[model samples]
Target: MKAKNFLTTGLVLLATFSSVVKAQVAATDPLINQVSHLLIETNKQGLVKAKYASAETRLADLIKAGRSDEARKQMSDLISKIASDLATGQVKADDLKNRSIVTAKKLQKAQLEAVNQYVNGTLSAQDLVNTLKPLNSHYTALVSVLQRYQDVLRSGQSTAAPAQLATIKAGVTDKSSILYARFRLDLLGYSNDTTKDTLTDDLTQAITDFQKNEKLTADGVLGSGSWKVLNQDFAGQISQLRISIDRSRWLPDNLGATHVFVNLARQQLQLYVNSELSMDFKTINGKLERKTPILFDSMTHFILNPTWTVPQNILLEDKVPMFTTNPQKVLDLRMKVIDDLTDKEVDPFSVDWSKVTENNIPYTLVQKPGKGNALGFIKFPLTNPYSIYLHDTDSRNLFAKNDRMLSSGCVRLEKPFEFAEKVTQSMNMMNWSADTLKDATENLSPEAETSTRVKLVKSIPVYLFYLTADVNEKGQVILSNDNYGIDATTYDIISQK
Candidate 1:
């Protein structure tokens, strides 16, 4: 009787210990259940429908069946779609619902794997918590940042001015201020000794660098102009870059091994060889009165001695009056008057000056190409409706100026000869040397009655883009001048879409 009671007591104690161990496991392993409860709450808020819930359940079951890799891939694809919808401003309640379901499925899978790994002695409990904590914090921060920007955009505020900074105090915090300061420091590559309070020198140097890059006045003060640029939300800028990258996905993957790329907003041209930048130069864009068109094509031919057929607007407004008012002025400027009906050059003494009216003339005036010609020595030809091309300019001094938007519509290159040489060599073609260019200019005479044609051995690609910001080869972000006033328009269009 005593042996039987002892055995029974031992069995009862064993049963009680097993129950306690199971309870401990259940209490500690709540990650999967926590994620599952979150999904259920999101669904109650009308975030997910029946079909998505069913799919997510199936995905979770598959993960339990040890198909975690496939489940994770599916979840990643769904997350990417959700991100895209958010970027395009098309996020519906249903989209969020579906996202929650997918996220729940992924979280469940991750938790199961984590628990199993811990049981197998591959991961400690502390390690699991540490791994998840940072990820959760980062996601929360990202969502908060995105929501803040979205609210600001939706408010339909006008341009952010210095006076408006006080009004936005409700939306900003010390954390945000610190983040912006850190970002500015990173952009300028400040030393480790730089601190928040004594950041005057760093800020001054950064402002100077920003001004130089944007081609603005290089004063090292955070005035209205500089503050306007620096105050932009860094997250918004990153989002804009992402949108641009997506838009560029429709473009041809390979432009060429070598080509010329022009960014209209920056007013710069870059030469790329084998996906690497070989050289770059500043360029003069079209004047405000005449805007440059976005275009993509190949340069078919080039002209060594190019004639500038005086455009009708210029001829009617400026040239005709100067010739009529002062015949000496026309002669001094190397212009000769020609008869309307005869198609022959006329002497200054022969023209009936008083009879020249808008209705009477049937003449076409042409300017011969020379050193003093409007188009200096070379012209690169392409097909476009605007009659625009890249050409050499007689006013080389203008290139030295930071802002060079003096052209009618065509692009004026700083170093035309060098650019032409590089482009021609890239295309396996030959171009005239500096001596040849000079000779061609000097050889233009009255006796040569017709324009000469210069053909290239090969064609080179040309891409005209408008980018206010870009990443350089060294992964540095370059902010350029928005001379055309397109930033606001672009931002609106992107946000709306």
Candidate 2:
């Protein structure tokens, strides 16, 4: 009986020993070691694991507590910092920790202020909730991207290719890219319902919309060019815009309560009244060579029966040849040859066109404004040596083109009539109605038959700005194309200061 009991005890001890071995093997598995290594590296890199989850929870709590601005500011700062770090280098763990602490304190202060403001009826509960929604959404996205990036950096044995890294960075801030993504999600909350195929259709629609807006050939493929633009660093662009804004600080602050604002980069115009956008429209900018100047000035007067005094350069280069080849061409085009001999308009057909030389052209070519005239129907006269005035163009079709650099040096406004009307109305001008304007235009003749001047009763200010970035009402920054290639030159000038 004693021998049998001892044998049983030995067998039980063997079973226990085998269980310990299996547990040890499982702990030391290669996959387990790799995962452990990833977590450690991620922590060391100052990447917070479960960042999305944490951020979402925090945002929810903030919203519930009615701290919208605080949440927004925090998320904005956080994303900005992450973008900066990605562009530069990894942020120090200590710095991040310190920043997080500082942010917490700020949030607390903001929360108290918000609560007080709410109690005082400064902000309604619904307003507070509405404001918080964007902040919460932004934070959620930010956290998601950051965590995904961290995971890519950690789990993936290989580092992301330079191109991939660049793409990721650009996607974070590019409005076009974000809008495209949002469109793909149909602005509907992301769902797990794949079998319904709604996501695919949504993505297709998103691509089409993006292509249409960008003025690209609307093939549904999201090509590299589109992707590159989508991934551009908007924070950098905003910084650049800030630099431009500072450069334009030399301009007068009070451009009047009503004025026109043009952002060259975005190729847009906004007519503002008392600091609100009364009207907005698309615009084409100067081409590469004949780029628009960045300056501020006011329109003093509108010349309805205006005359286009041919530019000296055009006269010297273009007219000289044309006059020599066929003087009748100038005559037919309604250009009066101002004879240097008499300082008066000479009949182009009667001139001895063969004798005219480059140095002694002996006359100025002036085109009296009329139907099919260069200045169209109106000209907004301003003081500038470049002869760059805001003027209507007979070639209205040029405005429809993507590259609107056809002008010699003048600004061709898309809606010049409406624009002029707005300015005139703002100035409290007399008899400046559409009827009066129509009468003046119809009666416009080369004889200067009437004093067709829509003189401003009060002069309104005009600012020719070059803003590359502008924050919309929704707080999203809008970027524009650098048509003039002035971004680099402007950036250099700004950096020096």
Candidate 3:
């Protein structure tokens, strides 16, 4: 069998990390030392060895020296999470299945008891390590996946040599040209043999799948439309896809059969129902100054005609002082001051005017439900710590902009009410599906000036991510611009072999 020669010298050179670049991280690195201190202990037993042995040896060093602030935070989160799961117990089958490289087999009785001992502080670190030895599979999976993608790129398997090969079809006896088409199909994960050179039934169907995804004519023919994309710089884009796949390693393999998937890079949200694409919406995410962190949480419920309570940070930074100088401005907008905890109405005059600053604002300022609420008429709330929800925006015009990353951090949905309605309808467990919605008052009303919390009968998962390169419905490899400049920064860490 003739071997595939795909790796260009340039790609191999680009893929290899320099020794100097590798040495940026030293033993004295603060974060590394911090991770070490947690993993290492004197005369440790059970908790510190074997299972955690991988964590001790690998987790800290997984992060490279030139890591960006966002990448640093992500790495810190990964280590902290591993430590947390280790300290508690690893239940890999739950929603956090992707938290490690490989899935640890179901725990046996003795292993479970050892973990219990660690939880109660009765067992040593090595004890914890030995008991949760399966947790090491997470690192193994991570390393293996990372290595596989890097290997594909390093071997020059993804890139095709410059060629003006003749257009080839399934029945045509064009072995050499067929090899070129077969090569691309393989890189994109459709396995076919280019060495055969002959277009087989499998290769034809593979091209059809690729063409269907690419939104081209799926006639089992390789022509101009398919040829142009086939010869483009897909090798680089494959690396981007690998990064996205790796990110999912921290999430459930099935991100909920029915859930909302938001791609921060594309500024788009995809609603999936039974694994089929249902609705896709344009989303405005965080600006660079207030970059949005990727989040995975369930959509427990939605709020209708919801009053917008000004968040503490926004009140301090933008509103409090603005209102202090011109108290009438608050009244003009129908904004009310409310007690922080109870959320009951409070008079603006009851507070000392001089004491209100960004750092010292005591009361919550909320906008009434009419047209002026920053969170349009409804909100789809994700149960996350960030308090970032998917909400409608007063500035619908902003969606037309090419760069839709204009929000502080929460996503601004173009058709938020529609989305909320769809979700409510899906949750037939609730009495508030759109058909019953008209009679159901406070289902996110346009007139309620105060906040109203509407619960769902069934919870839907929401995954906020930045997948810059993805295979779209057209099956074409689409790569969006790195809106937050993350791809360049995190490339080294993710791309390392």
Candidate 4:
């Protein structure tokens, strides 16, 4: 019966992908018409070179000659090329179907073999479940990704008319941008009705919802930031989805029983315990110019009341200018400049402010460990060449903002103490609880300026990845804001494939 069930499930999963592709292909004539129209519309918007760069000169010449029949034939040929490319994808899907069936049979056969070990009272139930959990997780992730891919393909077939929206705020009445905003918001599932184009209260709320999801400032105004995201047409969205799917495949099949996954695109961190979500933390990542690198490492340790050593870039660009203008800022923050050669603290008041330059900086600026410390109270260091880590921040007000990409390179946690407690419990650090950890710092003297570093018994795996698209808990596909424009860069390379 289990074997039969496995066969049924496999068939259903494959059918879902196969049916969607087949249905789209079945209306080949309409599909061609749709493609032709899309090409023309995109060309008008100077986007012809995106996918049809090779055919651009020829198509242009044909259009110039007013050869309607030949132009249609040329477009038909292009469509055929696209169809041929997609057919290759179908072949790959068919190959996956075969492999899945074989794997399912092998799994069923292996289970039957394991039944004998169970009958002999050798294989325990918990052990069996543990063995199967990774496989189950792998299968679930695969199916979820496949579903998202199919949904994206289907959505592309129903591209809304291209509408360009200009910057506008609330109470803006009867403008083309307003109309476009309404339709675009409605299409994105943030709004329901597009019949009303004016910036009504309903439209304002919808824009606000869209802004929040996109990680933009939720001011409920259709400004440049909002328009930038809403302007991603069907082709651009499809390209993004393709890139996301390819990147998703790069992740390990099993991300361990316990791990930390950071999505740089969403600026969020997820902690999974026993392969189940334990906690979700809002994070403030790096700025657009200073991007947080995508990497994989293990969190080896965390510090309590961590002292912040200002990086060279920060010193040169931010602090030096501030200190040059107003030296009092350094004294207020309890910042000290240490001579790099002598390893001794230098008085900020002794240095000539106007003479200091980035190239001639001879001292390292370090902030003392206290309430005013930049690295707040805790710091989780990861083993990476980028020198980026997850840590607490003194700027708590930044968390309240909808758009929280305000860091230099490191990630700032919203709930650092809670995260520390979870990490402590996970490592089973000898009798250490959140309260005990708090107590360690609670009694610190004002003159004390040392950080306590607790090395983990077992390092927790950490993955810093960028994914612009994700499958939500409810099985719905959602898009994240591409703050770093990494998606566009990645799509350029993957589109060739």
lDDT of each: 0.51, 0.49, 0.59, 0.61
lDDT of 4 by residue, 1-497 (tens): 00112211322333443344334332432333344433332221112123444453464456556675675576556543333222122112123321111111112345444434433346553443333222323224434444443454445544454455467684565476777677566545555456766667888887787776666788988787678777665445544444455355344556778898888887888888777788887899888767777666789889988888898898888888899888888889989889888999878888776776766878888898867788887889988766689998889899887668899989999978778888778767655566776666534676664788888888898877777765444333357767776655544442342
Candidate 3 yields a Cα-based lDDT of 0.59
Judged by lDDT, which candidate is best? 4
How many collisions between residues are there in candidate 3? 32
RMSD vs true structure, all candidates = 17.9, 19.3, 12.5, 14.5
Off by over 4 Å in 4: 1-236, 442-445, 495-497
Model 1, which residues run further than 4 Å from truth? 1-182, 185-211, 216-228, 233-251, 327-329, 336-342, 347-361, 428-454, 490-497
Residues 1-497 of candidate 3 have per-residue lDDT tens digits of: 01111211223221232222234553334454333333442112112122233333243344453445543464355344444444332222132322122233344577567644544446665555554433322232433333444566556564555455777774677666788777767656566776778878888888887776544678978888888765556545544544443343345445676888887887888887776777887899988877777777788877766778787877776776677687777787778988877778877766666687656666878788757678876677777666688988879999977678888889999877557667766655555554454334334345444455788888888877765656555334444676676555444332222
Q: lDDT tens digits, residues 458-478, model 2? A: 565665555444444333334
**Superposition-based RMSD of candidate 1 using all C-alpha atoms, in angstroms:** 17.9
Instruction: Give the lDDT of residue 108 in candidate 4.
Output: 38
Worst 10 residues of 1 by lDDT: 97-106
Please give, for residues 1-497, the per-residue lDDT of candidate 1 as tens digits: 00112211222333443343334332544333333333332221212112233334554555556565665554444333322222222222122221111111123355446545543446654544333221211122333333333344446633233334221122233443433544553443322232453334555566576666656677764455765666564444544333233223222335676777877767788888666687789888777666665556677777776777666556666677877787676566566555667878877656655566676665556666666667777878776655678888888889888777787767888877777666666656654665555555545564553445666666668776555555444433455555665443434333331
lDDT-best of 2 and 3: 3
Clashing residue pairs found in predicted model 1: 47-97
CA shift of 244, model 3, Å: 2.1
Model 2 — which ten-residue stretch has the worst lDDT? 97-106
